[model samples]
Structures are given as structure tokens and as C-alpha cells.
Target: MTRKPSGQRGPVDHERRDQIIAAAHEHFRLYGYKKTTVADLAKAIGLSTAYLYKFFESKKAIGEAICSLCHDTLLSDIQAIVKDNITPSEKLRKIFQSLAHNGAELFLHDRKMHDIVASAIEEKWHAAIAFDQELSSIIRNLLLEGRERGEFERKTPIDETCRAIVLSLQPIRHPALLEYNLETLDNDATMIANLVLRSLAP
Candidate 1:
């Protein structure tokens, strides 16, 4: 319980709420959001369903909370990378490389993450669509910047081209994008980064 702005006592445990969200992340990451029930979440956190309901009424809500945490972190990372004085195309490469090279875990783990998101809600839910828009926007910015820097053709429409580039990179997160036995996923990411840089360069 806590004191409200109105001076009456209210009840909300923000810290515990985050703990539950963390537990939800682990559960969803393992069993996926679809297969993970509220009961599972409650059990994982050592709480009853009734208590879990007090925090998050549904599994979808918990899933959204987990996705929000992940998406925010990635978005923040992208923003920081873009803060450098690099050209737009360079920035785009840096953004992707950071995810693929620096954060390979994010790409590989996305297999389970994708399943969770797809199961928890519609593909266009805020968390999913927001990321799509954020990437598209980044690509659009880079396209416009590339045209000015002579790094790309001026005829390319900013939004469409960016979306295409973003979609193309999705295969990197796919389980079958390349054979893991032949080369490590890290090597594949490097190959992909080089391929995109060379192929997309003017």
C-alpha cells in the first residue's frame, strides 16, 4: 500500500510488478507466449493465479510488458548509434552490425521471441508495429541521407525502400537463414552485413 496524491492510502507495488514482468520474460522466452498460461507465470513466480491477476490480468498483458522492455532497449541502442557523426548509410550499417555483431544473442533469441509475439497478439500490435515503424523510419532516414551523399540512387522512394531493406534483414533472425553447423551464426552475420553493404552501396 502507498499514499496517493489525494492523501488517501492506495496499493501498488511497482517493484514487485517489475519482478513479475521479469519472470514473465523468462517463461515466455522458454515456452513461448502461446503455450505459457497465466498459471505457468504464477507458478514460475511462486505466486497464485489470484495474486498474479492482481498484477497482470492476462497472459497477453504480461507478454506485452516483456516485449515492451526488449523493444525499448533496442530502440535506445539504435538512437545512441545514430548519435555519431557518421553518414546515414554508415549509421544504418552500424545499427545492423550492433545488433548482429555486438548483440548476436538478440538475433538468435528472436526465434523464440517471434513465436511469443506472434502468439500473444496480432502482428500489428503496438509493440510489433512500433518496431516495424522504427526500423522503417531509420531506413528512410538513411535512404534520404544516402541519396544526398551519393551513396544511393535518388529515385528510391524513402519509405518503400527502407521497408524493403528492413524486411530483407528479417531472414537473419530466421532459424533457416543459414546452416549453423557450417559456420557460426556470428560469421553469417558478418557475411550478411558485408553483403548488404556491398549490394546496397551506390
Candidate 2:
């Protein structure tokens, strides 16, 4: 996650930064990310463009913040899934399904916000990287639990297995790649999760 900017205006004031993000989110949602400008955002919120820079370095930075917020919320939901009273196998299935559905919702319904995420993925922004890392960690823990419970094989190293599972889900997980598999993402997510579970069989 990018550090929330702080300047000579005393301690960090997230109220202003959050205000900027709230406005940007609405603006981006309305006008799309690429077509919107920082100055336009400043105008929308009644702040000067220079003052807007105090919280975010550039337009991309603001985009990153918005993108990160989305990722964080999704991650929290997924984390709750992990904590649910479900088997590791079932958790894995749910995780993949949720990811596929979320991607489809973004691309098919929220095109404007999807544009921000697409750019974040294309540019390998911090938000995307951080989301992937944290997700991989969650998957790793799930795999370890499965192995300990004899629900999954332990022959393969967890890291390699985790990477393979992540890669297998990437077609649906990635924004840029979502369109190609849009028609079959729901079925594909379940099928892929099942396939991974089979491979992990003890």
C-alpha cells in the first residue's frame, strides 16, 4: 500500500485525503479514469490543483489510492471467507468463485472503475502488487491447513503449489485478461478450483 501523504500541514490528515478519494471515486465513476484530469477533480471538490497534490503526487497516485481501496475491501471479504466454518477445499472453491464473479461484475457492470483497475494491472501498480501478495499469502495458509488435515497432498512445495493455483486463476483474476474469458468465468472458476483440488489430492 502506498503511504498516505503527509506534508508541512502538521500531522497526516486523512480527512482531506479521504475527501479527495471520495470525490475522485465519484468523478472517475462518472467520467471514466483516462478522460478525467487532476484539475477536474480539484474543481469537483473545490480545491486548487496544487492543494490536491498535497495528498496525492499525481493523477495516477489518486487512481492508485482508489484502486487500493477497492482491493482492500475485496481482500477483507475474502479473508472473512477464509475464516468461515468451511473446509479448506470449500474455502478454495469459494475464493475462486468470488474472484471470478467480482471480476465479471467490474468489467461487465462497472466499466469506469474497471478502467482504473485495468491501468493499475497494466502498469504493475503498487495496489495490484500488494493485492496479489496478500492473496498469495492467504492461499498459502489454506494449502498448509489442507495438508495438515490430510485433505491435500504434501509432496509439492507450498510455494510452487500456491504459485500454480494463483496462475491457474489469473485468467479470471486479472482485469486485462478478464474479457477473453468473460463468457465462461463462472464455470471456469469452479472447474479450475476443482482441478487444483484434484491435483492437491492426498
Candidate 3:
């Protein structure tokens, strides 16, 4: 039997890398980042730890990849909501609520995974920064649309107003703020959104 050339391993290598990432994601979600070691991930995929290292240099590397995937999924959701055929005001409200809801679910469903996110943010990970920038951009675009539609009045520059909006809702969107009870978090989000809307009213 003829063996495949080394250059022909691209597709197979990509597939294996993805498999390793998926396995690591599940392990981290279930067992927390600190508890889920490279050995565990390799065992899950029926590979040796040395082989896993060929795909990801370290466990932190795998964790970063997983965080990137999650952030991409979130950005896609926000992008879709922004482009939906809804009033700018309604879209803004939904975007705020969706972000709060997603953060809360992540905190409550898997504290381990949430901890990974917290560390990523604290470490200033590239994926975390990109995620934050994308979210800000979405909000800024929505505010611009609102201004064009005369649904909102901007007392300050659009960029400043966008920053204010994000800061005002940080309690709901920030992982550190997820320590509050669910009811309190929900109420705070509602009140904050209302205040932002009122501030932006024409």
C-alpha cells in the first residue's frame, strides 16, 4: 500500500486539531480549567499527551481556542440581531437583554467555564479583547441607526455615547457582576436599559 505524502496531511491535521479543541472544550466545561489537564484531554480523544501537544502547545492554548470559538458564536448572534428587521430601539433592548442572559447562563450553568472566561479577561487575552471590540462596534452601529431614525437623541458624541451605554450595562454583561442573584440581575438590566433609552430619547 502506498503511503500519503507529508504535504497531503493538511486536511487530516486540521480535522484532528478541531477534534482536540472540541474535546478540551467539553472537559473544561465539565471539570473547570484547572482540573482538566492535557492528559485528560488526550485520554478523551484516545491520544497520548505528546500527540496532543503537537496540535496545541499547552492547555492554555487549547483554552484560548475554545474561548475564541465561544466569542465568535456570540458575535455572530449579536450581528444577526443587529441586522434583523426590527426598530432600532427594539433591537438595542434585545441586544442588551441577550448579552445579560448569555452571561448569566454561562455563570450559572458552568462556573468552571465562566472562571476560564474571567481569567481570559483579566489576562487581556487577544480573543477577549476582540470579543469586546466587536460587541462595542455592534452597539455603536445600533446607536447610529437610532439617531438616523430619530429614535434617539445624542447629547454627546456617538463614540462617547456608545461607551456610556456599555458601561451602564456592565453590571449585567460583565462576568464579575454575575455574583448577584438572578432576579436582581434581571431587574438591574431592565432598569439600566430603560435609563439608557430615556437618556437617548429625542
Question: In lDDT terms, which candidate is top?
Answer: 2
Name model 1 segments beyond 4 Å from true: 1-13, 28-34, 106-125, 174-184, 190-195, 198-202
Which residue pairs overlap in candidate 1's backbone?
Answer: none
Residue pairs with colliding backbones in model 3 are: none
- Find the number of clashing residue pairs for candidate 2: 0
Candidate with the larger lDDT of 2 and 3: 2
Look at candidate 1 and tell me the lDDT of residue 76. 83
Segments of candidate 3 deviating more than 4 angstroms: 1-13
Global lDDT of model 3: 0.78
User: Model 1: per-residue lDDT, tens digit, 30-93?
Assistant: 7777787888888888999888777665676677667766667777888887888887767877
* lDDT (10s digit) by residue, model 3, range 50-72: 88877666777777777777777
Best candidate, TM-score: 2
Q: For each candidate, what is the lDDT?
A: 0.64, 0.87, 0.78
Cα lDDT for residue 185, candidate 1: 52
Candidate 1, residue 194: how far the Cα is off, in Å: 4.2
Tens-place lDDT digits, model 2, residues 1-202:
4354212232355688787889999999999999989899999989999998777778988898889888987898799899999999999999999999998998888888888999988988888888888999999999999999999999898899999999998888888887888999999999999999999999
